[model samples]
Target: MTDSTKPTVLIVGGGIGGVALGMLLHKAGVPFEIYERATTVKPLGTAMNFNATTAVMMKQCGVYDEFMAVAKPFSAVQVGNTHRTIDYKIDFSEQEELFGAKGFIISRPDIYDLLVRQVPKEHFHLGKKVISSEQTNEGVILRFSDGTTAEGHILVGADGAYSSIRQHMYDQLKKEGRLPATDGEPLPFSSLCLVGQTKSLDPSVFPSLALDESQVMTVLIKDTPYACSIFTTKKNTVAWAVGEILDENRSKEGEKNEEWGPGAAEAMCQLSRDFPVISGGEKPLTMGDLIDWTDKDYITKVMLEEKVFETWYDGRIVLLGDACHKINPAGGAGATNAVHDAVTIANWIHALPPNPTKQEIESYFEEYKKERLPKAKEAYDSSRMFKSISSKSYLGWIAAVCFKHMPSWMNRTLLSSMMAYRPTVSFLPDAEDKGTVKPAHQHSLETRRILKERQEAATTAAVKA
Candidate 1:
């Protein structure tokens, strides 16, 4: 295809989704540019858990090897009360053996760096925030905050939760009287999460911690002020996130702004004093003993009620990732689902006929929506449910106690479904199928072969030494 005929995708936001999408399109021989709102692509948040689906996409983007170079692998997930062991520990090694791939816990910047390295420097324009976009019969026009304009065949609102492109699309649809009515009240879960990170703990003392350089470790302290602590180790640096559920209504209405309000450290400390965990073979557990409370800083995020837009596509512009669906981070599925959107879109666009018409593009967008919306909703609902289950008062405590005694197989089964989810589009054959979907195992086999080769080479090097 000539330069003029090449399909151009204008991706908003330089976060994980946008950059990963750009990398996929580039690998597919498609021309695209990622316009990031940030002045520079720096590490934005703490760590993120990359399940199997996203790991497959990262592998396809040719950055899986790069990720393996720096990321740590999670062998098991431990969940229990502060004082005693829980039966809910999940050992992913066998599952990884079964699936032929392992999950990774890496810093957000590590994945971003891998993607940015694959993309051509010229194609990524930093500090170019998209202000508005206009769809035409031929293509779409994007106007940016820097007072510049660029036209492309399609525009992707990978800009994230507060997407300007999505707003613009909704406004245009409303003007044409095609928008859907607002759904009832937002999600009922009103809680704020304080996310923060700290210096790596000494592995000798915190032997239970997964400091494997790539594994993500989650500690659920029952009947404690701290609801959960999610930590992922990356090289010498270890990233941690602590979340305290808050009253969402009060935070939203601007009633409470204290750094340590109702569900702050002090409250957690009080809870710890009430329910002591038997640690180091001792009694009367303290908050300082459980976590490094003094050294860590926390960022408070009031969990907004979950809001799913009535629609994700308008004419030629479409929403991807957090732009269309916002899920609670209780399950760490938001980032994974967002990355899946990027891959799904790229695969759909690649499957279209060469030099397709505008109608063809719209059709592709429709198919993309039909396939992805359910999966996005599933992740959203699962996050809400998990949060509800985790935060129940008395009944929740009973269930949590029961979960501690559940069989290992049951817990593994539950987590496997979430961690191994692959979009429907990823399994399609390239111009050679009768449309029957391939089993997920086939893809797992491919991943296994690659991983095995890398392992063998490592073993050989070690033996030589």
Candidate 2:
């Protein structure tokens, strides 16, 4: 029972997903508002990458040129053990071969900044914590903790792993006996993530890093408490993250784990004692150096959690990003997948019929869930498998050997297949991308990568012919 004349969208959370979706909706000439719980938008979180799929979406959304300046696009990645031994290297260094496109390794906050800048400041409501939501025949009404209320045609939750909107949605379902089991505490935190950035370091300490203008390295520790380290550097500074397997410890007071506040920065640093990155130099480089270089304010320590839910929508309310599927940061796929969800949902909304009914909105929700649910699960599984392989155990041993012994060309080919790029929305035009240098072999890789699949009817017609 939405307004026949005006269609409005209310988006919760101002993270990558919400902001990205807002950008798309705005471009599509739809009216929308973004509510962010935080009073201020800050660039935080570990360094993340924008794979080809992400780049394609950004291009479709028309924001490629704006990011090339701040983003560092690299043609190679080096993965190995804690000792700095090279295992499987993805060297698309020769711009001739099509690795599709180099990934943009930018920090999380930077991405937020990029997205927020595009949207009008008036549309973004800061410090608006959505305490509850009510859906009626006309529209959905949102109540903020500040005792304010706002109504919109539909509510989209992009809040994060611990979503207040999701809780409200689940509460409604449980009250109706529709949800049998409680959503429960997040799929037990698989590991704890300790992330921070270092100040400028001299070239002499790590020559390869210095040579490449940026260094990307990962260390695998495969014992009982499995762990992995991701270290990336640009110019004088290095951004690093280390993952430690969390012991299954739950107290009588519910589930007990690491708390991310107060002295968290200090405690997270202490966990990196033996986790060293052995360089080609005589002395080994430890997390201690990076920890000391980074200010306590920049440290991010949290238990990494991942899950893909069975339920996505309840009536006029729908979920996106971490609200729908929480993923480990191992593959840098978390935010990328969230961006994908935003674009996919936005396109569906952009094409809605005039004065759409509640049933019409629910159909779009079903379509979104049908398409993105599987994508979320696929990305989640891939992230977990990669996270596990970053170990020193027998499985890790096999992975390391396969990576080290695997032919480089074959590795590159497998890398292409594993990326599993999703199609972009058909409505948006191609973004102006002057900065991306097309590789020579792009004829086989890049060109083939971007083409949309033929419609089912078209394929059927071809088969009959």
Candidate 3:
């Protein structure tokens, strides 16, 4: 392409990450187009939590204020045993004082809408699934399942988990004898999730809900399944997701087929039986009583992990969001992390010297991988550990017991760490000194020392073992 011709960036999957990246690129005056396999965007999934980091990025992209207006913030998170409230609670007031911003809870579609509104309709081509793409010294060529073809300066595999682009890239490498094949492990925890909307909550009941409008409330039960319910918008509508740990082997191979389908409603009913909010369980819980057995299967296939890929980029093609790292909905990091990936990548691209060379583009991706890989792995491991701690087994019970008695300060510290986490990116200039706002407070020297000591201790323990 000539210098007069704007270099096109092809983005696959029009989800939150894809759209957010597109909007950022558009604002930076970069040429790009997004192709979504779906014919139209729908508010399909449940609720998500947005940490201060994600909220700040959204604000920079011009949707933070409007998005905040629609979401409700939970000022405190509660954990309980049977009917007794545990002392463990995340104090949002303290977090706000530390981070200088508040978190948000919003519907998946609300974020999608915010991103779509910023992009030109003509730039988006729906129903076009990417089949494969190849890169050359000049640019990249992409083929769609619809039999159309497009050429661009770069291709992004933001297609999400089960991404055809990722699969194709793997296939290409395998054909050239580059990678090894092995059985993929199922997630240690899997659950049947039921999600739907309900009427707005009474303010008198949930006084601690933070979202000005959309608030997510997660309640970790002592002996029963984990249940969470939250409002997604200012409208009186709420969405809830209930997870029950199942036999991983039985659940994956469909051995427990009878347990699914209609069993979803039964699952919620079981929640009421095991832990009744009226009897001191989490409050404002009505799904068990209001939902009908025939409530049309809203449950989706269980996920092993929020993310499926270990690496997110290859040559000129790259993956982001759900395509790269899928997080469990429990911690509300899924959507937030995805948006962070978009902003991070956009910033990396912006920081590139003017008219970067092909080797520089490749080097940029290398730096991206180095910076994001550890953070992605840490987030993934944290989610898995949290899920295991909330399961319905003997060990899970023991964990709950231990958690219940743990110091409230310890719990608060951990919760804050999860919310305030910022992935270490090697390429970006010092974000703070550069005048770019950060989501959390700067890491203290004491905290850094503690982290280093912990890393050393763990390394030594592993070596000894």
Candidate 4:
């Protein structure tokens, strides 16, 4: 692509979605820059899961091998009680046969490192927090905290739930009386989580680490507000998480605006350190044991919010991932959905014409929302469903029982619907469909195939001449 035709993209937020979008833009040869508020990237959070759909996307992005190297294939989730005995198991053994790929689990930092390595170091501008943003007829500009500026043809907010770009865009829209009431409302979170991964340890001590496949053991303390989960990753390190159900009416003031603040992590870790865990051992284990093995710097406390905004884009600025839809972490679809958002938006951006007008850009952004919003809403609901089963309320216990006794056929049908919408980059060759179940129709892929045929025909005619 010529420089004249390329639209320079400015991505705010260097998290999974932002970096993943950067990598996709890099593959398309589009000029882009990523601005992150933090001076350094730290490995934070717990385990992240990749279903078959996301695995296909990883393969398309040329990072699947690296991802697999640090990830373990996930087969089942065992829900246990205070006695260290599993109450029920959600088996995923049929995932390979059903989706043509095994689901994998990796630590959040490992995946982030894998993604950022794909993009050039020069593309990232660290410690440049976007204080505000503006857009005129020509392009968009971001004003940073350091009193500097960045100009680009388009601005993307991959900056998590409390996105600066979203705030700036919404402020302008509200002044113009275009912002929706729901969009203007504050993000509400009902649960808080403390998550971290242990340093690589001897597999002999942690028997779960010795297993080839991933094992997720979650222990729910009955009648208590606490739940603890442990997952074994590829590097012989165990990813651990402690969740506490918070009052919906809890004070929003003094809440850490940053997602991975260490102060909150440390406090929550101290409170839940004695929480019991089932670590594939004859003797009982506690979250404190894993905490002792983990680096304190990597621990994070995050408020799990659930919301999908009514307004996603206005003019040249748009939202992606948690910026627009904040899914509950309990569903395990947050990262996967964010990656989907990145891939879909990248396709639309690649389809943009040279020297495009604001109207044309807005049209493509609409197409992106049209394709992604429903999928995101579905994921949001699924995440909430999972969250309910872990709550301390009576409904939570009933939901858990229903889930445990749910018919196998019914469960498979529900999963199939969730897994059917695997999207790939339109500018790249489509990944071969290896599953028996046909995937849902993707507009970008359809356009990709049409363009490929036209390009091939043009090449053939030129050869004949």
Candidate 5:
């Protein structure tokens, strides 16, 4: 049963981030309903890498063990050229020893399914395309395309890059001249990506499929506009992607924007099919082989864009995940960052006062943004840096060389900064800090402790009276 004192949360969009937040809120005993525009969930995209940044929260939610089952361990990435010559390797083997958590790679849909099961079926509503949203002193309301309405105390826009909720919020803010000029601008994308996963292959055919650790092999052809890569999965399948780095102006002017769907990927797949891959097999492979092995219905093409919004919350409506920040996937941190946002947002909501006032709710939102904004920017910067290094330009070459030969101390410092921010739900027994490097300060955890102490003291005095 829900405590009437706690605010009921309405989350828009049923992506991984939204579902993740729903799971946390459920575990914390808070009421939340997730609304997705699509009637059925079609798990798209390739795969994602999750490390200490989110493993602690998964454990707190009691899903870490299942997550481990669905995911393959990730240790290092082998980068090379189309000629099959090794360039450099990005090592992650030290992550576990330094951060006290192992990194894993899992198919996007597999993890989504795991998280979705944690929430009750009734709480996750589908076919609810939210057209617009409005909030008042009493609560917030969402009007769907089908003319139905739902009300809740808090509204969270977890929609993707082209978020309708964000457009509506900006529309209102723009009319009042409160929205930043940058926020009103359209999202710009430069790179086009084709992502898909092959069916489970024979271990004899692909030797790497038998390994415990997911082997990531990437090939960057010199002076070419494309980068192709493949990853081994725990299920004996291989996930692959081909990214075409386009000139920003050229892409915006000449190319038709590619939407993320099945048929949309065919064109890009054809263009990159001939690109070479360094799969650890008896013979060399090409992107075409993997493309042919993958089911056409599961492939998707999308335009990669990066942006961090200035306004995350106004009134009772707040935004999380891709709705607020869209980062390139080149750094493999986009999903991790989204998961981090969900964790922080859930923490704040869980710590809220019973029947929180509008001012109090907004204050919590403010704190959530304050804690996540810098981290989002850091991820954004790291993504762009990685994207640049993966490109075929002269600058990309220089960046890659520098990274390959970076001093050990410098490399450790950089890795530490990115890996030291593990946060758990404040409502649960926090995950033990086992890393040699202590985690960064968490505002929500500190706030929850103080609030708990105050409530206990008040209860003692009332009992004595």
Candidate 6:
């Protein structure tokens, strides 16, 4: 258990970023607590994709073994027209080789569960909704919807896109007239996505489809607002989807949003039953199979949103993940980037001295922003580009040819160059250790001492063995 007297971090949101940050702080011997709005951390989403960069970080965190055991690792992505007129595939084997890691596709809840279990129950507070925050020279205080308050040495907003912490931070900045020109813009949406995972289907049903192989296949309808991406796992199931941006999918403006729960799951199933996702081999696999196999509770519908905020921090409060930069799911950076932020931000916090002054805290946050903002922009740009290139435009056509129709060897060289640039966790043993941006006088001496002792113990045990 964390000592109450120790310097503590209050992490808002209980998703991937919040839990991962708690886990890392625990490793650094830092006291921290996670506050989440959800009463229970159930499997919340359908499917998730992984690339080499994220894979390496997961391995470093010691969750790779378990993640791999449950996920389907894919080495390529296949894009084709729904009519089977044009079929193309991009092989990622060489890219995986370059990054020293393979890619994976897994159920979102399965991965979420794995991350949650690593953080102790004592560190988390479920059913707690953070509404606002106030900070002074000493530390920060959080105000919850239930009229309760939480005081901590630092406040990190790992909340999602509709982050209350972010809104509070922005409000404070504007009140100070530091951001008189900024706009809290809403995300623009061009497409709607319906996602769900079905019970394991027989690979024999779709000839040429190999079970247990790692790969992504996408079906696009030309000249129409329709597309579906499927990730097949050896676990006897497929995560599939059919998406469109029709008016029927959009919510009326100025209306409060209530979650479209599992009751809407059946609606998606009905719409997808006859929609074909892949027309390969003698028999085409239609969305009907997926809808029929998946439970009503597993389907989800959402308007895909992508954006990056210009400001990320103010005083003792800072932002991470979707709170600051929301990304399209095309590149699968959504969850990976969130976890990466947790580690990077934890590193900066780990460098902070006990009872740090306001100036010291602000400076460290500035340093954190310097390292992260560019990476967030890159993800935002890439995800936006991916969304566009998945369409029927000339650029999309060129991408399909260059990515899928190209030779296998050429494909590896082309994709790996892009894959290798992805951002990863910064605190792993093999990770690049750029020590705190703060001066040596403000360094985390206790953290350094503990880290040294751990290193020495490992050496001693090895020598004794």
Best by TM-score: 5
| Comparing 3 and 4 on lDDT, the stronger one | 4
For all candidates in order, the CA lDDT equals 0.63, 0.70, 0.60, 0.85, 0.85, 0.71
List model 5 lDDT by residue over 105-180, tens digit each.
8988898999889989999999999988998998999999999999999999999988888888899999999999
* Candidate 4 structure quality by residue, lDDT tens digits, 91-142: 7777777877888989888899999999899999899898889999789999
Candidates 1 and 2: which is better by lDDT? 2
Can you give the lDDT of residue 217 in candidate 4?
77
Task: List the lowest-lDDT window of 10 residues for candidate 1.
Answer: 430-439
**Whole-structure CA lDDT of model 4:** 0.85
TM for every model, in the order presented, reads 0.77, 0.84, 0.77, 0.94, 0.96, 0.84
lDDT by residue (31-138, candidate 3, tens digit) is 789999998665666666676656445545556678877766655545444444444533454445545456666667666787789999988899997777888877
lDDT of 5: 0.85
The residue pairs in collision within model 6 are 73-214, 74-214, 200-236, 200-237, 201-236
Error of 2 at 89 (Å): 3.1
Q: What stretches of model 4 exceed 4 Å from their correct place? A: 251-264, 449-465
**Lowest summed lDDT window (length 10), candidate 3:** 426-435
Off by over 4 Å in 6: 1-6, 84-86, 180-183, 202-210, 245-268, 279-282, 404-417, 421-428, 431-465
RMSD of each: 10.0, 6.7, 9.9, 2.9, 2.0, 6.7
lDDT of model 1 at position 410: 73
lDDT value, candidate 2, whole model: 0.70
Worst 10 residues of 4 by lDDT: 251-260
lDDT of 6: 0.71
For candidate 5, the per-residue lDDT at 460 reads 100
Task: Spell out the clash pairs found in candidate 2.
Answer: 43-109, 200-236, 222-392
Q: Residue by residue across 239-299, what tens digits does model 1's lDDT show?
A: 5444545454454543244544555645544443333332223244333444453233333
